[model samples]
Target: MTTPQALVLGIVQALTEFLPVSSSAHLVIMQDYLGFKNPLLLFDVILHAATLGALLVYFRKDIGKIILSLVRLKEKSDEEMLNRKIFYFILVGTIPTLALGLVLNQWIKAMFTSVTFTSLMLLVTGALLWISKRRADSERGIEEMKTTDAFLIGIMQGVAIIPGISRSGATMSTGLLRGIKKELAFRYSFLLSIPAIIGALGLQLREALLEQTLPSHPFPWIGGVLAAAIIGYISLVLFRKIILRKKLHIFAYYCWTIGTISLIIRLAT
Candidate 1:
């Protein structure tokens, strides 16, 4: 890949990864059009790592509290207990997600090659976002969340593994449907993504190691990672504000527009 191509891919990954738009769909389309023959697996692993770093940095305080609570698990202050509970909620949410992802891995991979299918999934994502806009306002926080809520949201996350189904969009929509406050829903969605992204990277890392493939353009890969991390952090901050303002549904229009265009292209071709 060329430097410009790498930078463009990095920007797309960062912008769409946290947005209601699907990053995987954009990457697949871009890769196909650009005719990139490099080891995309390694490149994608690095790009995801960069976004993972952004997530950690953005949620450092929450993560720190979770870690501290775990470290002092037996001390049991009221606040520490609350933190522990929240941590467990995250763990509970990840269970169904991991299970469903493993089961659907091959199906998801196959869908990546079908732009028409991905385009249709984007329409589904847009519909979910639009539906979320009609949900009544909520004030529930992480402490108020139930196990069933977590599991259901996890299932949404798992389903988002399909190309063009935004992970952040699906989880946030599910959270809203479950009566989570908008800001809290957004926060938890990204927080939940930490484990999901890590697990994905771990699996990809193992695959890359086994394949013994490396990027042909190492400098471009490094540039892509840096670009992704920087842009991802900015996007995360902006998304928080958008969610707080209850403007998340605005992204639905974009998804619908893109999906329509993609469908047209597929039909014409």
Candidate 2:
């Protein structure tokens, strides 16, 4: 891929990585429709690592507080409970995706080659979003959730390992339906993202090394990584605001419309 192409894909990866939309779907669609060659899995690693860094940098203060609070001699009941539960929830959410990514990585890639599957998965993603939008208490905060709710949301995060499944949409919807507030749901979804994203990328990176699929004209990753991280950070903030304003149903409509169109295009092609 060209430098310009790499930059554009980096932006897309950053944005879709956080948004309710499916990043894998958009990447596949762009690669197919635009004739963009694969930039190798290494480039993908750089992009995700950059965004991971972005999340770390942007949330550094909150992350520090959370970490410190965990080790402190004394903490409030509610704060302590929420922190402990979220720590476990992150662990639980990472387990299935990491295991599945390692074991089923090839099978998942084969599915990616099938445009029909991508489109179908997008359709499934949209359906999920719409279902939650209709039934979920769009007003609940994550702080209001129970331990079971976190685990249940964790399961949905596991399912998002498939290309078309929307990780944020799935977890947030699960949280919402469980009566967690929108901002709280979004935070959990994104926070859960930290572990899941890193684990999946690491697995994929390992597979790429074994397969020796590294591209020759590798993008240095500095620019693409920075772009993704910067954009990802901004996206995280914007998405939180959007959720707080109770505008996620707009994303519900977006997922449905785009997924439907993509499916139709696949069937027609």
Candidate 3:
């Protein structure tokens, strides 16, 4: 991709990745408009790694607390215990996500190149966000989370493997619908994605290595990664504040509008 295109794609990825909108869908659309005949899978991996870095930086305090709690296994303070429970819940949530990702691997790859499929899935994401808004206020926190809740959220994350199904949207919406507290649900959704993104990056790297298709000139993509990582941190902070206000459903309108326009344009052409 050209430098300009790379920068634009990075910006789009950063914005959409945090919003309830689907980052994959926006990437596919941007790639198509930028005249990429094939999916930039390797470039995508690099960009994802950048966003993952943003997540790590943004949530470092929470993550550190969890790790510290786990290490001092002797500590029985309520806060430390809650953090430990959250750590286990994240592991439980990753299981179904891994299973679904493996099962849908091929289909997921194909969907990346299909604007029609992505557009349709975007509408589904809209529905999920809208429905989540209707759920009554909940006060449950990490201590109240059950294995079943984690499993169900994992299933939602797995389904989000489809292009245009926002991972954050699906997982967060699932948590909200399950009556989890808003802040906990938001934190858990992104924390759970830590494992999922790592697994995806690893798999993609292995595929590139085995196929001997690694990009020889990766410097062009580095600009994109930097853009994604910087803007992604800002997006994460903005999204968290929005989530706290219980305004996530507002994104559903944007998703619906974009999805419909994409379908109409693609069909007419």
Candidate 4:
């Protein structure tokens, strides 16, 4: 990809990744519109790595606490105990997500090829988000979260592997329906994504290496990564504010509008 194309893809990936919109769907749509025959696997991996870095940087304090709590196992403080439990909760959540991803990997890849299917899924995502908006506000925080809640949320995350099904939307909606506070739902949804993204990055890297699809000059793509990281951090911050403000339902309309238009265009063409 040229520098301009890389930058465009980077911006799309960054914004959609955290905006309760499907990044994979947007990338597929962008590539189709740009007439790219195949995705640049190496470039895609790099973009994801950049967003993963952004997640780490944004949640560094929480991650640090988790790490410290694990290392100093003897600490019986409530905060340490909470951090340690959260670490276990993440692991539990990852289980169903990884399993579903593995089982549906091939099917999900096929889904990426059909814009009609993706557009339809976008409608589904919108409905899910709208449902989340109707849920009465609850005060359940991470300290009150249970393993069942994590597992259920993870199942939704796994299902969101399909194009147009937003992972953040699915997981966060699940958290909300389970009565988790909006802030914790938002925070936990992204936190759970850490393992999912890492697993995906690992698989994509292996595929890129085996296919020898690495760009002849990767330096140009570095700009894409930087753009993604910067925009991704900002997106995360903005999304947090939106969710907290109970305006997440607004995206439902955006998704529905886009989905309807895209579906019509795909059908007409």
Give the Cα lDDT of each candidate: 0.87, 0.74, 0.90, 0.89
The runs of at least 3 residues in candidate 1 whose Cα sits more than 4 Å from the true structure, single-residue gaps closed, are 37-39, 209-212
**Ordered list by TM-score, greatest first:** 4, 3, 1, 2
Candidate 3 has an lDDT of 0.90
Better of 1 and 2 by lDDT: 1
Per-residue lDDT over 1-269 for candidate 1, one digit per residue giving the tens place of the 0 to 100 score: 78888998999899999988999887877776677644376677778899899889999999998899999878878889878887887899999999999999988767877778988889999999999987648778867889998899999999999999999999999999899988778878888889999998998798867766676658987888889999999999999989888888899999999888988987898
Instruction: Give the per-residue lDDT digits (tens) of candidate 2, residues 12-99.
Output: 8899888888877777776676574552556666677877888888777667766876897377777766776677767776666566
After superposition, the stretches of candidate 4 with alpha carbons farther than 4 Å from their true spots are none
RMSD to the hidden true structure, all candidates: 1.6, 2.6, 1.4, 1.2
At residue 121, give the lDDT of candidate 1.
88
Cα error, candidate 4, residue 24 (Å):
0.6
Question: Could you give candidate 4's per-residue lDDT for residues 1-269 as a string of tens digits?
Answer: 78888889999999999998788888888888878877666777889999999999999999999999999999999999989888998999999999999999989877877789998999999999999877748679878899999999999999999999999999998998999999889878898999899999999899877766667887668878999999999999999999999888789998898889889998999
Which stretches in model 3 have alpha-carbon errors above 4 Å?
Answer: 209-219
- lDDT, residue 158, candidate 1: 91
Q: What TM-score, over all chains together, does every model reach?
A: 0.95, 0.87, 0.96, 0.96
